[model samples]
Target chain A: MLFDNTDFDYEISFLKIPGSDFNKEIRDSKFLSPEEGFLRGNLMKDEYVPYKNLTYFKLTPQNEQETLLLKLMAYSFTINDLNLYLDLNPKDQQTYELFKKYVKEKNRLEEMYSEKYGPMTITETQGSNYNWIMDPWPWDNTGGSMYV
Target chain B: MFKYVKHLNYPINIKKKDLKMAKYLLTQFGGANGELAASLRYFSQKFSMPDEKGKSLLNDIATEELGHCEMICTMVHQLTENATIEELKAAGLGSMYTEHGKGIYPSDSFGNPFTVTYFAVTGDVLADLSEDMAAEQKARATYENLINMTDDQDVIGILLFLRQREIVHFNRFKELYDYYKKKGY
Candidate 1:
């Protein structure tokens, strides 16, 4: 349908924000940090999202550790989204590099989180005991222990 | 083969405990066109998928469907969270309560457990991809039906997200099918 209109400008246009080259700048400037906030994901860094973002739930007691957990979650979402993009545009180097970077960041954050909190994955369990089933189980609305 | 994401794809915080509505929602949890069946179908279908593109796409979509399943189960759980045996009996969930007792069981609203009869994993690339498109549409219709039956805003929100996801998955599979057809595969 995109090509059906026959009014193709044929311009090589990349994703951009209104005032600035958003895609060009985000490569080096965007990051997963506390002040930047992980709750927004790539949606914010790429596009200037309005106040009404995608997140529907608010986390209680925003702390450094909690921020880290949210960062990992955000990075994972970014990677997952990028993976889908790459499935079709596999040769897009820019996105492929971003995907790799996010995967690394996500792994580091997951490790740090698992070390301090409980293991987010089975491989993160350091002790002899299988701690994957300790608590939370993803359905506990207010529970902190079951972050994946 | 997969890692838990620790959070639902979208937050589901339903506050109501409507057991009749719960029965309706249960159809989405493990019904024929439910999330569990969607995930199982894609995951099982990937083994016979001809190329890596189809395999990985199916894997990720299937994984997302599991998260959808989790969200549906959470909704079902919260709805029945406070219902007592007597209350459940009145609500016609007495048999379900007797079997699972406030826990989630992978079954339809009618208590039919998940079965492979709901899906297929035929090794044909075109046929499997075509089936996926049909599955996504079917799941979307089921969610739309649930949305129509519900008055709870929270349930409606999650159902909307799930329905949108079904549409997305359908489009993706359609793209893959088009690619195969173009290549004369």
Candidate 2:
């Protein structure tokens, strides 16, 4: 598969470092895997500060729908974190490239998820059926089946 | 313009309902240092940011805070949806029930309605960024307090995730603040 869960190795050498200072900064800012990032609510390892020695909860997906949805959440989180980083350090070409990679993967995952399940966004609804109003809205008790 | 995404940033499926926990969690939805205040604070402050970096960072973070608001509301809703009137009364939400009747309302643990006074937007960049950083800390503390009140692993997990977000956001705001300071903005 072009995009797999293990594709988080963003240490590609093709992306050049624009400057020494920024290069050092990038080297300093280590990243966590998408799954870890999603679980911890942070992409950067240095910035993830646990409160009072408490560990985050582990998510165990019960079925295929949840498994895919979890992947989408992780990728989306990575993309958002990269976006915030890029917003401040726009000149960091390497991180920008990594950001693009996550975005692409997340987009593909979202499409795949929508196709298999129902539309997550109104625009991504597949087929003629308007499944946007499908049951188990995120807030609904039965919605987050995997969460239990 | 914003498009709705049906999925939450994180999944929240609280299989066990706790009315007291729900009452406490509502503070994050409408408290002084809650998600609603955080979102509005950034939304209002972004306009006067010195550069595109500050503007975009504030804008994007504000957008994320809105999502957090939804998450908090969802949690409160799920936690209290199945509770009876007696359960609500015992949980100290009886007064709240008279007001909103199991519906999620923006108010603190004390049932004080959310007000614009909870946040402020000074046109000054440094002051605004400082406030933003402080806001994130306050929020992180609030999440910790909430986590301490609940023993549910499910609720704790979500609270922990949200708390971590505050740390990340604090770092981001501090970075921007430092950048602006270096540039003498």
Q: Tell me, by lDDT, which candidate is best.
A: 2
Across residues A19-126, which tens digit of lDDT does each residue of candidate 2 receive? Answer: 435344444657765666787798897776777757676666777887788888888888888889899989998878778877887899899989988888899858
Q: Assess the local accuracy of residue A77 in candidate 1 as a C-alpha lDDT between 0 and 100.
A: 59
RMSD of 1: 8.0
Query: lDDT by residue for model 1 over A49-129, one digit each (tens)?
Result: 221122222333257665666556556656665676577668888768767867887788888887777787777776567
| Model 2 regions more than 4 Å off | A1-29, A144-148
DockQ each candidate and list the results.
0.15, 0.40
lDDT of 2 by residue, B25-82 (tens): 9999999999999999999999999899999999999999999999999999889888
lDDT of each: 0.68, 0.84
Instruction: Please report the TM-score between candidate 2 and the true structure.
Output: 0.90
Candidate 1 structure quality by residue, lDDT tens digits, B1-185: 56665556555556678898888788777889999989988998889777778878888888878877888888888788888888899989999888888888888878998788988877888998998899988987887778778767666656655666676678778988998889898
